[model samples]
Target: MPLYLQLEARLRHMIDSGQLRRGDVIPAERELASMTGVSRVTVRKAMGKLVQDGLVIQKTGAGTFVSGRFSQPLSELSGFSQDMRARGFTPGSHWLDRQHAMAGPDEAMALGVAPGTRITRLKRIRTADDEPMAIETAIVTARDLPDPSMVQDSLYAAFRARGLVAVRALQRLRAGLATQQEAQWLHLKPHAAILRIERRAFLADGRVLDVTYSTYRGDMYDFVVELTASSTTLS
Candidate 1:
């Protein structure tokens, strides 16, 4: 293999195996060149490939660093707070918009409610360890959230308080182009590819609990699903 390709593979392995964690600054090109007995041009080429692959980022006058990439199990119904905590990261949210409005077409269809039914819509910038991760918007029956102010960190926690725990949920995931507003919130350039997820949650009593639409930074989030084979044969 070429010298640059060899160096690129080594660096890629380090990132994949967590030898280089997210936000960790990589050694300077000169340092890497000396350490690996390669020319500075080879080192630059290796780093450039990593940058193009989104495995690392290069900042002028700063340094190259591992990019943040989070993986989530597609089969599970977990909230943002739960997911982050399971990863040993602090989860937080910054409220963007909170108000009561009549259910729109999409909201009404998802929640199985009338078009004019009042609903509480909450929008926030979700964070993990103080780093922005996603833009989330949640719509719930207004009756369930008489006082939206009472909701603080986790919306799930607030629902539990009202004896409205979500017993099940259906979700869909898609790749979408980020709008200007979404890009601004996620700190990405306009038209950046993002992971768009929509979910409809239900309570034990068969009532629609909430519907949520979230856009996660594509470079920073992944959806994983496991498959198992059944013993029964096809007839």
Candidate 2:
């Protein structure tokens, strides 16, 4: 096997086995070359392969580090708090706005509530490990959330405490450039690409629980879906 190929395989193994974890910085190319007894050209080639494969990222003046792109399964109905926690990140929210107001037509339709009905809207900057990850806006019937102040961090957790856990949800995903406001909150340049998600959650009794719109940084998030074929039956 070629020397570069061997180096690539070793790095790949480290990444796959979690030895070189997400956000973990790899050693300098010269150091790797000396340690592995390979030429600097071989190390460079292996690093290039990893970058092309999206397993690592190289930043000028910052060296190379494992990519922090997180893959979220599209099949689950989960909240940002739960998802971030499952990934070993500290989940937090910075409230942008929280208030009660008359439901707009779009919010009413998505939440299955009549227009002009009072509702609670919560706008937050979702953070993981103290870094802003996404911007989210959630709307629920005022009755479901009597006191917006009660929701300290996770709205879903607050709902569960009130016996209103969402049993299912429908979500839509889109790709777009970040708005100026989003870019500011997420610490990205204006017009940077982002993932937009809109979701409607429902309770066991089929009542719409809430509607949420989320914008995630495209560089740090990826959505994955698993599909399977069903058997065909003939009579």
Candidate 3:
């Protein structure tokens, strides 16, 4: 490989193997030049590409560092815990709040419940390798899920245990400015950019299983999407 390409691969490998972590600053350009016996130009070139690829971040007065990472797409179909495990990261949740409450107007409408209907409201911060990745506020109809203590690291897992089908999901994504409470939980600053999502998971029989509003740190997350053309035949 060419010199710059070689450097890029090394940096990427460090990130892949967790030798370098999200938000961990790297050696300075001059220091990297000395260590690699490459020119400052070459070192800068390598770091530049990494930043462009979202593998690293650069602050004006600060040096280059690993970019914080979070699961993009945020699809329950994939199962959040499974995805994190696949990446070799320990997934955990520190349940901050759990309570039974009446559904609000929006949540009631989403879950096809009366405005005053009871629901289980659970608040948690999903973490990977003990780093906060997303803040989740979840609501499920008490009629569907009576006991809230049964909640665990994965909501879908709890649903499956009860044979509650979560077949399809409707989700909306928008950009939100972080609030003070959200900032603290997600380890972000107040008013920082966040990826906001409101999702309604459905059952095979078309029952809404749960509704969740989640906020992910923008700098730490990127949603990946793939599109393919469909084939058709004339009848």
Q: Cα lDDT of all candidates, in order?
A: 0.87, 0.88, 0.83
Query: Residues 1-235, candidate 1, lDDT per residue (tens digit)?
Result: 9999999989876765456778899999999999999999999999988888778999999999988676577888879888777666788989998888999987888889888899999999999878889999999989988777867879998998988788889889999999999898889999999999999888888888989999999978768788886898756
**RMSD values, in order shown:** 6.2, 5.2, 5.2
Displacement of residue 103 (Cα, Å) in model 2 is: 0.4
List the candidate numbers ranked by TM-score, top first: 2, 3, 1
lDDT of 3: 0.83
Candidate scoring better on lDDT of 1 and 3: 1
Angstrom error of the Cα, residue 57, model 3: value is: 4.5
Candidate 2 lDDT, 92-204, residue by residue in tens: 98999999999989888888888999999999999987899899999999999989998987899999899888999999999999989899999999999999999999999
The per-residue C-alpha lDDT of model 2 at residue 43 equals 98
Better lDDT candidate (2, 3): 2
- The residue ranges of model 1 lying beyond 4 angstroms of the native Cα positions read 1-21, 25-66, 232-235
203: Cα error in model 1, Å: 1.2
**Segments in model 2 whose C-alpha atoms lie over 4 Å from true places:** 1-22, 26-53, 58-64, 233-235
Report how far off residue 34 is in candidate 3 (Å): 18
Off by over 4 Å in 3: 1-49, 57-65, 74-76, 229-235
TM-score for each candidate, following the candidate numbering: 0.73, 0.79, 0.74
* Candidates sorted by lDDT, best first: 2, 1, 3
Write down the RMSD of candidate 2 (Cα, Å): 5.2
